[model samples]
Target: MDILQELRYRGLIHQLTDEEGLTKKLSEEPVVLYAGFDPTADSLHIGHLLPILCLKRFQMAGHLPVALVGGGTGLIGDPSGRSTERSLNTSDVVEEWTDKLRGQLSQFLDFESTVNPARMANNYSWLGELNVITFLRDIGKNFSVNYMLAKDSVDSRLSNGISFTEFSYMILQAYDFFRMNSDINCSLQVGGSDQWGNITAGLELIGKSTGNKAFGLTMPLVIKSDGTKFGKTAGGAVWLDAEKTSPYQFYQFWINTDDNDVVTFLKYFTFLTREQIAELEEQVKLSPEKREAQRVLARVMTELVHGEDAALSAIKISEVLFSGNVETLSGREIEEAFKDVPSTELSGNEEIGLVDLLIAVKAAPSKRQARQDIESGAVSLNGIKVSDVEKVLQSSDRMEGRYIVIRRGKRNYYLAKFV
Candidate 1:
């Protein structure tokens, strides 16, 4: 498929300026495109995946992708789509976050390739050196307060009050785009729909200063069928970082997608062709009993983010845990499978007793609750139902000599480490 057609088929194209013109322009030679990521948090959540994925797509099509890290802009948080004034993060905090964000982004874009390899740039490099006077005289003159206020970022904040720091964010982002456009010959910027105003400002800067044109494209914010935000589950933001959000939890998050929302998500997130997605949708509609679509969504994302091995292990752990067939699973598999789930690594301490293990892991609310669960056949240790009121802790029972996977019925695996 052509670039435009593939983007359309994968449901990656949101809003692009002059699609045909841009497509025609891109067809001739390799071009440069950019997407900026704000280090607002320590980890990049699924919300950050769209732009990163777009960068991958662009690079795959023989274009260079500049993944811009917002070390500078992050200090003055972008007010776009925010309901209230943001609590500005400390410079040190943001810098720390920026480094981690760069690492997470590295997992998405191919930076080691000899051809069209992705490049990482930080806006802080240029933005830090600019004097206030030069900034105002050079780039700031092009954007008026009236014009900035007219934009949506400033519009929604007219009542809540927009700070000068926040107001200047557009200029900073524009400068980043300008720097990329000038230094790297990067002419395309991609972001979420909310970034239209800031992205347009960058285009205006290019037109005014260099008399060049740039393009902006965005992907729709992932949202649920109920109009609620996506990438959130009972445990919280479905982070790509396993430490923040476990693989088991992440897999379950996708597997539990509402019947109505799975198809839309498959279109938005997965690289499946139109026919493949259509088939999944058809299965959901015709055979609602079989959840083929949700399963595919879970597997595709799991494999993309984690890897085939991780996804398989997560699936195995999930099947064993959910299927209530613990006998088939080894102790090592239990720990590997529940790595992302809530776990407490115990040391090989012969002094630690089973009662302390259950309470320490919070599998039981109290000693009495622990006794109750053990007696009710609901508690099992290493796949064996344990009813011994005074089961002694043994170094040998410790799976892998330091841990044991305890389960409460068909689900909820808790790990206890003997220290």
Candidate 2:
């Protein structure tokens, strides 16, 4: 299938400007397209993946992709999707975050491809040097106050009192598209659905300035069927940085996808073909209990972000915990597996009685209850039934000599960490 067909098949097209024109442009040559990612935080999260992957899709189809890091605009936050104003960051902080985003983006695009190698650009290089007179006269002259005010990004914020800094964000972004079109012959710009106004502004600027025909495409913002925001866990946003959200946690996030949303997410997030996704959709219809679709989504997404080894390890940890075989997990895996579980820290590696250990970890309310639970085989330590009330937990009982996995009943889990 063609690139457009593939994207259409995946339901990725949200808004496309001059589609017929773009189709002709794409067919004649490998059109250069660009997407901008502003570094609002130290790391990119799952929210950024759709466009990142879109850029990858374009690249794979023999087009050149430019991943633009909005170092310039990061300093001036876009008001497109915000009800409130953004706190401006210092140049040093924005630069630091910009570098981090640049590196993260590098992971997705193939810069080494001999035919159509991906390119990276930081808008700060140009925007920083742009003089006020040049910006106002040369670029800003093309936009009318009425036209700018009419944009959804600006209109929505009028009630909330949008700041001038943010109001001018559209122009800055337009300048970016114009700059890319001028320098690199970039004809297409893609972003989330919220960016339509800003994107069209860029197209307008390009048309007025260089008389060049530029295109804009936006992907639908990912949201769950339950009406909650996507890419969010109870902890916070699911970050691309493993340090922020571990591979296991990332895997679990997708693994827990609602049955109603899995197939759509599979279409949105993965490169899995229509037939493969169709098969998974059928599996979901036949055996929702198996969660085969969710597992595949988690595995593919985790491997894409974290790597094959981490994905496999996360899968193993999930399986081990699900099957009540916690003894097989390594210390790291155990920590990841029980990251959100209640934990008690032991000061040192001291041999403690099973009842006392259970009480200390709060797995049991008291010695009497602890013993009752242990004797009833309702408590297990490290995946083994510890029915002996007199059993003592020593260094031998610890997994990796540092931690013990305590399970009380079928579902409750606690972690005992020996400091």
Candidate 3:
């Protein structure tokens, strides 16, 4: 199937400037397309994956894809999706985050393709060096105040009061599209649905300035069936950076996908063929208890972002934790699997009685309860059931010589650290 047809089938297209014209252009030749990501944070979260993957989709179709980091606009902050004004970061911080975003984008796109390698561009290169006088006289003149204010991005922020810096963001973004079009002959811009206004402004700039035709397309905002944001968990935003959110955590996030949303998420996130997805959909209908679709989504996403080794490790951790055989997991896997569980740290390496260890880790409330729980076979140390109340846990008993996994019951887990 054609790229646009596939995207449509997957429900990726939200708003298109001219579907007929863009389809014709795409069919005739490889169209150069670009997507902009602002360095709002040091790492891109799961929310940013859709656009990054969209760029990859275009590249896989033999088209040139440019991943644009919004180093310039990031400094000013886009008022597209905010209820209030954004806190501005220093130029140095923005630059640092910009480099990090470029690195992350590099992972998803093919930079070494001999035929149509992906390209990276930072708007700061052009936007940073732009002369204010020239910008006002040349680029600023193309956007009238009325036109800028009418845009959804600017209009939505009128009541809350957007700063001149952010108010001028539309023009700045328009200038970005114009510059890329002039430099690389980029003819298409794709972004989330929220970027539709800013995108059209760029098309306007390109049309009026160079009189060249450029198209705009946007993907729908990802939302959950439960009326909550898609990429959020109880902990906070699901970050793509492993340091912020571990591979295990990332995998679990997708693994917990709602049955109602699993098929939709698979379509949005994975490159699995339509038939493969259809089979998974059939499983979802026949046996919701199996959660096969959720597993596939988790595996595909975890492997895509964190690599196969991390994905496999996460899967093993999940299996071991489920089977109550976490002793097979490494120290790192143990930490990741129970990272969210209650934990306690005891200073120095010393042999602590099993009853005391349970109390220290707060797995048991009192000494009597600890002993009763242990004697009743309700306690386990590192996955082995411990019925001996006098069992002493020493340095040798620690997982990786540091951690002691304590399980009070079937699912309740706690961690004790010897420092």
- Judged by TM-score, which candidate is best? 3
lDDT of 3 by residue, 1-419 (tens): 48999999999999999899999999999889999999999999999999999999999998999999999999999999887899999999999999999999999999999999999999999999998999899999998899988888889998989899899988999999999999999999999999998999999999999899999999999989988888998999999999899999999999999999999999999999999999999999999999999999999999999999999999999998888887788888887888899989897558899988888888888999998998899988888898988887778888788888888889899998788
Superposed model 1: Cα runs more than 4 Å off: 326-376, 387-393, 408-415
Model 3 lDDT, residue 69, Cα: 99
Per-residue lDDT tens digits for candidate 1, residues 1-419, read: 36667777776777888787788879987889999998999999988888898888888888899899999898889999986888989999999999999998898889999987999999999988999999999999999889999999889988988889899999999998898999988889999989999999999899899998788888877778898888876557889987777666678888889989998888777888789989999999998777889888998898888888777867887787766655565655665566656788665655566677789788888999888888888888877788886888778776656667788766777877666
Clashes per candidate (backbone, < 3 Å)? 6, 0, 0
lDDT for model 3: 0.92
- Report RMSD for candidate 1: 2.9
Give the better candidate number (2 or 3) by TM-score. Answer: 3
List the candidate 3 regions with Cα displacement exceeding 4 Å. Answer: none
Off by over 4 Å in 2: none
lDDT of all predictions = 0.84, 0.93, 0.92
Q: Residue 310 error for model 3, in Å?
A: 0.7
What is candidate 2's TM-score against the reference?
0.97
lDDT of 2 by residue, 296-390 (tens): 99999999999999999999998998899988998889888888999999967488999999999999989999999998999988898889999
TM-score of each: 0.89, 0.97, 0.98
